[model samples]
Target: MDVMVPRVAALPAAMELLDRLHDQHGPLMMHQSGGCCDGSSPMCYPQGEFIVGDREVLLGVLDLRLFTGQVRPDAPEDADGVPVWISAQQFDAWQHTQLVLDVVPGRGAGFSLEGPEGVRFLTRSRVFNESEVRALAQQPVLTGADWDTGARPPAATRPQVVTDVADACAIPGG
Candidate 1:
């Protein structure tokens, strides 16, 4: 089988933060915001805290080895690493580059779990060269069903919020 390149990747510093967050938060996930205002920054949250919708996408998952001393309550006794996610639309624009999730000391404006730690997560990117782009082109891109039930609207379709199970079911193949 061919190995696929991930749409999102983390640096060691970001992994360290993820390890610390996982120690306290149990498990974690990230969402890359596409709206204005702190939207450009990726927000980290305790798993399932945020309501993922069709507008969002799962860019990739990160496996940050549990380096923190505390074992999360929900983690298996012998759990190895934690998982993280990124938004799909954000990935479309950034597909040609590699994302490096990092942390810097500063207060971030958003509900991201890390905001209270006096630090926030940031993304650093580098463009993919021809070879890397070619390799990435061969990889399968993640869609809504691959990560969650929410189905993104077609590019020509306007997006709407699914307020309840009924609304979610109303979506085509949602």
Candidate 2:
């Protein structure tokens, strides 16, 4: 069986910030900014607070547990991680690249939950190699529409990764 390539992952810094955010704000969600005030930074929010709409694409669920060494009270009981989303248009433009959620020292987007934390989420991307692109082509892409209907990736695919290199060198995109 072929494993699907994860579309998103996170760095250790991001995981640490997320752990702090999760502790303060609860389960979290991340969205790629589609030209918000912060340009294209990844925006983090408390889960269930942002109502993702049909135009949003669920890139992948990021399991930060390994990098942060913290078990989140993540909401999606089935996934045990945070969901990362992008606008459908943005996904179309970035389909060939994989996202890496990194953290930088700065104020986050005004509307994002991390604003007060003095750290902002950043999105670093890499173009996929031919084999990875091919493998990803066969993978199912989930969307907000599917989520609203209570759909989720099967258990096998749900643990989409987001870990630091030292912690998870085995996870390709992570």
Candidate 3:
């Protein structure tokens, strides 16, 4: 009975920034930037603002509790976590580690929601232990492009396929 490890989690400071952004904007989502400029930084957007295609992978919700690796029983009942995403290809390269979202003093790379706040969102990672990796692989990884219509999965759009967990690594979708 292992605690299910989250593929992505935000540091408390990063969560604080997310809160500020949510107050200014609205429901939010994040995408992992892999190309020029950002060099693997995380981009934030208003939920439904960014179009998720087949190549995107839903890293999982960034609930306040995810960083602790456990969903608190006393957590807010209405906690609809901020969804985080990575390119499908990025997921493959990062699947062996845990993706940690953090904030730093600087301007965000692109149109991420936090750009104007004088702090930029960045990703810091840790290689998962064998047990943690197993836990992550066993969880259902949602592939955004499969049925995502700029909406979150398992409730808004069609539920993501969970059977794909049988793949080489656990996070299920593509």
Candidate 4:
């Protein structure tokens, strides 16, 4: 069976930053900035610290062990997974791309967790190739609008489908 390609991936430095932050904060989550002051930087927050609103989108989850090169005996099956979110409006703008998280020198001008660490999390991306696009098409995408009231898909249930993306990537509520 072919392993699915992740829609989001992290560079080494970014993963290192995540490890340090995880040690300090216990757990963390990330949200990709749509634009404005932060540009497209990825903001890391304590898990559930930032209220995911109706305008945000759930992009995908990243495995810390895979990216951080670490293993913990106490880690649960899903313990290493970190959720990555983006604004639905932003997802509409970059649906064909893969978000690559990277870290760079200098304090982030925004409130992202790394701002005070002298490094800022930023994004670099490339358009998906035809094959990647085909594989992505088979996967489900969740939009904030469909996740009304900011409710997450129940853990024991299958992901809810907001709408079919069969018509050339039109966002459900766009």
Candidate 5:
């Protein structure tokens, strides 16, 4: 199935959260739970690992290690017939925290964004169902998935220079 990379437009709330994360934590990693075609959500590694589906995407950035993987199309169906993508272990770790998936529709093409908060609609071309949102939110990560254990490296140290290039290039007498 053809998968598309979703475009992220952080809303005020999302942007605030992102800034808070950057200021307190570090870079952000993303993942997703649901989408079209076999109902598989493709895992994307934007900075680290960002998962993308036909209509949803997830963005994550944390100090803890987390499991991740792609959802199988033929996976066993939940009570609602929507397949489970993410694994149980991952769910336990992410429990209590709300994950949001944003959906966007384009001309014959569309994408979604999923994170630990609310979902944002990107485009007006496509339609989605409540079940679809739940399915996407329910996507799972692989058991024993890799995690980011190391702390984000400190921002590059500013170098000490003898002279400023711009000032040095200025006309001496001018």
Candidate 6:
């Protein structure tokens, strides 16, 4: 019964990306996965391909596919293997947010984008620093080394696992 919508602050960027996608792909849905804090970030899809009721928007030249999901949370620690933890409540809140955007060409065979407002300049190149790729791979949504290959792993893989060790401390003869 919990209806999760993208935070309203992301609307402008989402709308812009949606329009650009429509212009390029002629109304289709654009799907993109990857984020800093959550599992899946926002990406745009062309109009008809991802029909939101009856509105069709376009980007410059790329078609988009719209899929709903949460943004990938930031790595707990930087690539240095530091420890990080986001509370379950905070994570749950983020899980309900949505993003909309289109992928654009990068300088050296990579991609950039028009993401949520202040984040429009965000960009990534085909060549990733060894550490950057490693950090991204740590996300449940990205499995193995295939993340760098432009393959979307799966949403079901993002759940965090926790194990209680108290039972292991039971005394045999206390």
Listed in order, each prediction's TM-score against the native is: 0.71, 0.82, 0.74, 0.76, 0.22, 0.24
Tens-digit lDDT string for candidate 4 (1-174): 144546776666777788888878867889998779877779999888878876677777666776546666776755555678998788989889877777789887678888789888877775677999988887667665655554443232211111222222334466
lDDT of 6 by residue, 31-144 (tens): 233344524433433322322211111111211122122222452211111011122333344323221222333221112223332343221112223554454345443222
Model 4 TM-score, all chains together:
0.76
Instruction: Say which candidate scores most in lDDT.
Output: 2
Estimate the lDDT of model 5.
Answer: 0.29
Q: For model 2, which pairs clash?
A: none
Candidate 4, residue 59: Cα displacement in angstroms equals 1.9
TM-score (C-alpha, index-matched) for candidate 2:
0.82
Q: Identify the runs in model 2 with alpha carbons over 4 angstroms from their true place.
A: 68-79, 155-174
| TM-score ranking, best first | 2, 4, 3, 1, 6, 5
Q: Report, for every candidate in turn, its global Cα lDDT versus the true structure.
A: 0.61, 0.76, 0.68, 0.70, 0.29, 0.28
Stretches off by above 4 angstroms in model 4 are 69-76, 144-174
Q: Give the winner by lDDT: 3 or 6.
A: 3
lDDT of 1 by residue, 6-48 (tens): 5566655676777778778867878776667895887888777
Task: Please provide, for model 3 over 1-174, each residue's C-alpha lDDT reduced to its tens digit, 9 standing for 90 to 100.
Answer: 345566766666777777667657766788888778778789999888888777788877765333333343554522436788888888888888767777789896678888778989877765777878677667667787654554443432211112221221334353
Model 2, total clashes: 0
Model 4 poorest ten-residue lDDT run: 156-165
Q: Note the clash tally of each candidate.
A: 1, 0, 2, 0, 22, 40
Better of 1 and 2 by TM-score: 2
Total residue pair clashes for candidate 6? 40
Q: What lDDT score goes with residue 95 in model 3?
A: 88
Weakest 10 consecutive residues of candidate 3 by summed lDDT: 159-168
Higher TM-score: candidate 5 or 6? 6
